[model samples]
Target: MTVTDGVQRVLAELQRFGIDRQDVIVSTNVRTRLDGLPRSGEREPADSGAAVYWQERTGARRVIAIDHYIKVADNLAAIAATLDAMRSIERHGGARILERAFTGFTALPGATAPSWRDVFGVPPDCHDMAVVRAAYRRRASSAHPDKGGSNDEMATLNAALRDASTELGKPIGGEGS
Candidate 1:
């Protein structure tokens, strides 16, 4: 599908959810010449993703975005695929998808920090700060430099503890055993 056609499909899907065209924003990196032609001998950038954002009727802002297109090289084609995914999401009740798109985990390019659960060796849904603290102390005992652990291990443990503390809305500082 052409980029324009993909954009139109996304807008129509948004409209089905009571989102007005004016209230929705569509974004992509594809740019066309004023005469609607690609420049001669010039290749477009390799960015092939798009994002759609709108404010829900409940005053909550939501977004559906895709920045990765596996095995897709052409920008327009990638954008078209991403838009198709967006429409499919909305058609199949996209509340969870929309929420996750807006507030999902983000990592720096080429560098991913370990998740709090992995660092603490806890279950994914472990949210109790007490459990977190206990895990931290237990890990710290083995990770501390004085206990045959390296500075890097201790640092990783401390960083994980701080992340969990903040996520659980607890105070930053805590005694580790």
Candidate 2:
């Protein structure tokens, strides 16, 4: 399909994650929507990359800013699915939205660091299950799709939890996240 088609599909899917398009500010590789508003004459810096924003002003349950490569064609399916998985945190009222947003960003073929920078901020060297169950779980629950997050995000969390548990020698359903 075309880029416009992809963008439209993405917009439609965002609703499923409880992200209202009205509350969004779109800046596509091809155009900008908030142009009518007072924009700083300055454009995004060279490496800043493209992004999608959703938030309270947009009346969304949460805001998700996704970074992507402009050269590659956009894929709405995975994005929609990811958002759905992430709904647990994005749709509900809470702040874990920050971590989810950062951790879950994807990249098109040629994307760079934004796509690979441990968005979750969890260092590979850091293995503190006690911290995950006690602090991380509480922090993440605020936006978990099951609790208030989107389906896509909840799915992502499920996977991350599984990975963390397997390595830590714990079950996903255990007392920790």
lDDT (10s digit) by residue, model 1, range 12-54: 6667667887787666555545643232233434765566777
Query: lDDT of each model, Cα atoms only?
Result: 0.67, 0.50
The residue-by-residue lDDT of candidate 2 on 1-177, one tens digit each, is 444455565567767655666765545344333542112233434443334566754444443444454331243334444566666555574447676665556433543332111424466666766554454465367557658767766555555655566777876556653
Report how far residue 14 has shifted in candidate 2, in Å.
1.8
Model 1 backbone overlap count: 0
Q: What is the lDDT of residue 64 in candidate 2?
A: 41
Candidate whose lDDT is highest: 1
The TM-score of predicted model 1 comes to 0.37
Q: Report how far residue 49 has shifted in candidate 2, in Å.
A: 5.1
